[model samples]
Target: MLPLCSCAVIQSHPTVSMLVTHGPVRCGEVRRAVTTTSSPGDKSRQRLRSVRAGAALTMLTPLCTLVYVATTWSAGNRPAMAMICVSMLVLAAVALAGAQAIERAGRRATVQMAGLVVNIAGFTALALLDGGLKSAVGAYLPFLVIMLAVGMPLRPFLAVAGLAVAGYWTVAIIGGPAQMSYAVIHTIHTGIIATLCLRYSAAMVSLQRRLSDLSRIDPLTGCLNRRGFEERLANELAEAERTGDSAVLLLVDLDGFKEINDRYGHQAGDDLLVWTGRTIDEQLRTHDAVGRVGGDEFAAVLSGIEPDGVPVVLERLHAALDGVASAGIGYACYPAEATSPEALKEIADRRVYRDKVDHNRQVPAEAAVAGARGDGARRQSAKVSRHERRRRAITETGRLGISTPGMGLLYVLLFAGGHPNRWLMATLLTVAVTLGVTTVAAAARLSRSSAAAMIMPIVGALQFTICTVVVCLDGGASSTPALGMLTTLPLIALISPRAVLLPFAASAFVAIAVFVGVSSTWYAIGHLTSALVVSLVCASRGRVAAEQRRKLRELSRVDALTQCLNRRGFMERSTAELAHAHRHRRDLSLLILDLDRFKEVNDSEGHAAGDELLCWVGATLRERLHPHDVVGRLGGDEFVVLLSSHSAGETDDVAGDLEAALAERIGVSVGAGVLGRHGTDLEGLYAHADAELYRRKLARGRGRSRRPAAPADGNALVA
Candidate 1:
């Protein structure tokens, strides 16, 4: 029974713990805690300048050893000389490796301290191993002073000094004992030097901390600046990657900051910024960090938090910022929301702007009321004054008995040739009839009406009959005269242009026909020549006017920045296309594209880069699009495209292609929306497309991945 009880106890109590007294905690938990601590440390860690100094010292130590070797060789004792040479080589190698380590590992101040120790210890060992100290101690003193000057903390400085002193004593004791007087003097000198060096080192550390603070902190808000925030965030991410711990970063931006600056002045705006920064800082945990990454923009790094906790953190931030006199807040979290710094910032900025827009919408209502009141008052005042001025002008005109010029000229022409020749009368009547017919025919042709097309031949026949009548009236001379009249009619009609040209052409043709029929051979020839000259003059004038009108139309349709079709052109063309598609039951698609974060570019790099970016985007679209696809530049970095034959899937594919292309070139996200056959006409299509575009833009603002519109076909209509 005793043996069985002992066996049971031995089996039940495992001896693993007995072997090691204390067991280790889980490696995962230890890593998690380290990661959490290290995240905050990265954000608030002070940069030590002493590391650079250590590197410099390490490099100089090797050269100093060489100098010591030369001096010792001059003082020559053969056996000790070989030891000195060997010691110098060994110390130099150690110094080189220490220098390399310090230079490579910047934030490892502990490692740098260890390197200094090695360097100092190696010099001490060399001193004891060789008899070169009498000459080498002085040479080494400069290096020790340099190490102290660079920013080694007091402990490291003192340690180095102790090593130097010990090494000197070891050399003295080994070479043969020194006198008491010399030892006492040496000790006093060493103490003074060490004290001064330590004091200097302390001064450097303070200076370095101050400079680091200056570089990293925002002067206006006491938050880390953008550079500091980025540096800290990157380190945090790296640590999270290594430790498998989740961390979140939030980009916070204050909305309507510019409006505050504009309305209340920049001083109030600056104060508001300071208030926001302080408020955000207070709301964050001690383990978190906040930074002012831009004007009116701040960022926070939350360590050791679940990704899902981001929304709660954002809510807390929002609650803290809400109802703060005149501020709006937007925040985006990392890992849970976005994997990249830029993506997070973009999401935050978009939300901020959305809030800003909402705020602005409310503000404008009050302004609108004020504006309406002012407008009403101004309108009443202007109405009375305008009526009075009109009355005065009418009275003055009545007193002067003034009449517009040109009525007399019109009457003179109307009655000029009373009892006009029968041939001429016939010519005039024929011209009128011919012009009416041609005018109707041209209108029908432009309308593209089948009924009009059927009437065109009849109208053309009527014109010919009128000319024939005029020719018969004038006999053989009428042809020349008829041609003259035909030419003159079109020219005179040009005064009213579109409306009058056909009638004028008819009249000129009839006149020339009558002249050619009635006149003698010589008269007919003269009439033809005169008519030819008149027709040439009229043709030239009409062409010039048409050219001018075309130029005006072109100007109206084009955007100045991108040279793409303007909004008016888009609306007009879209309306026409919709009407046609509705009538024909043909398929049509509309796509709208908007550039992301365009305003930021405008803000940071000035409007010039923004303009350049827009132009580049337009050029890229043009190059990528098929000839038939119509691309138009809408206002403010917005563009629209029309695809005549594409299905929704094809359109989506094109959008994605375009988005990828644009992303490569400008680093701007392009959002696209498509309108399918469901769009009854151009307007409906455009509205649907625009809605989709807006939805895509909103999704992008929410930090979602989006594809661009399909590449346009070469044959697609471009505005």
Candidate 2:
């Protein structure tokens, strides 16, 4: 008798205690259940993907079993095996139907739960008919648990694991005296699989949270970026429509921003921009939303506001920005002005343009900046160099490669338990050990030397060559070692640089061809086809991950509002640039520009306008300077620039130009220092620049501007 004799059908419930949670698979709902950093949408998508993969494989497993049983039937256990064979077919049919249900409407939890029940029952029946705990089919129970661990939440998966262990023991007892050794070994294996699955799920959930933050939040203003803002606006509009309440949309454009940026340098412009964003955000209700939608424009949404009360809010908004930048304010009331988001935005934009035209006659002459170059153009090169990226990609493959020998040793140990291949196992183990040591040494060399990045292709070729040899010695594509090729070949394709991939893939396929003689030709062909598909998929994912890493790296280094180097980015880049300058004995100078009366602007117009001004200032500096020059905001109202290879006279001339550019809207005090002439190191030179800045400020009678200068401490260049 099987565990099915219990008569207690595991009823599914939508709670933690249930054997399985049955409901319509809500995409992001489960992701939200846990406090994950990732957005609900991202987690939902990942969950659905796992479910689909698991469901597809689960459907195929029973069908594959049925085919195997049909092809190999024994006469001695005809009736029992025949009954189990019928059960396999029935389980396969149920799985097929369940898989279809999951596919039609994303994941159907009930269907998944039903499929798990069928699998456990079928595997148990097979174990009883074969040899219970001694049956090879019983070993497959852990694999089923692995699938569950990936596709389902932890609690339910634990329940399923418990169910599998119970079934295994029940079948063993029914078959006859239970083998304690077999029971212990099988349970340990199941437990290990469960532990690994739990760890993998936890890690994935963490990564998803980080990726979510990167995707949605605006780095600069500590407010919603455009994407996040739009999402919120849409939801607010939907709520307003549902509740029959009014929504107000306001669009504000900074006036004379270009003049301010052109005059003050980008640092001051960025300061103004940061201030503007902060101020507007402060003036708005906690529930009201604001976002920097464009270069010199911001938009805000006020939900559930009465039309009559809008004037009061408008008064506060106008008072907030008075004298900040002569901002052009335009607003539209939802359900009154326009129903849709796009329409409301259009109406608001047109009104703002009209308001700007009315406020200043020069509005007709002012043109919007075209094709504003992003912060990437300001840097000479990427933070991570091309060679370093290549090294990193190869290093991942080497890390995975280093583990192959241990896997091989494990295989050999398992084979020795049953097979008569002492010499063969010893030789294979020796080879695996030798290759593993070589791989570890090579990986170490690769990490230490950038030039070693190119040698990875050769190492990859060597790895595949080993796999091919192992397949031949182990008895072909059907052998355990042959499975290694399927896993290893795709990894090689994924991590190898494009220049090496074509040849590596070709050679890998050739190696696959050799499997035909040692193993079944059909198995060889299947191996080849499966390797190709898996390789392509893994390679694509690798490229995407690489891109994501690069983008995230850039986001970390750049200041959110100004798109200039934040203090950390500046110090890191400047130190490297400074080192290069010293190595080449090239001229270098550091300039620190502090905006005059910047805090007063923050107090008057609002932080949002001040932020807008600062944004413009950062843009001006980026636009006016060469790409090789480094611009960074070292905390409030102070911008630093490192001019590599610039002589003192040339640096002075550049400073003059900056002063002239910013003299119109706001005054800027420039302090200069040159390497060797002022001081040897960055700190010494920074000190020299600070003294000059103080002298200039005193001359202007400003009395050492409100914020004190950053100290020239020995760690000035430290990131």
Candidate with maximal TM-score: 2
Question: Would you give me the overall lDDT of model 1?
Answer: 0.46
Q: With candidate 2 superimposed using the best TM-score fit, by how many Å does residue 383's alpha carbon deviate from the native? A: 17
Best by lDDT: 2
Task: State every prediction's TM-score relative to the real structure.
Answer: 0.38, 0.55
Question: Any idea what lDDT model 2 has?
Answer: 0.57
lDDT of 1 by residue, 112-221 (tens): 45554555555555545444333333223323432242233455556666765675566556656532222333444334433433443243233323333333444445
Shift in Å, residue 410, candidate 1: 99
Weakest lDDT window of 10 consecutive positions for candidate 2: 16-25
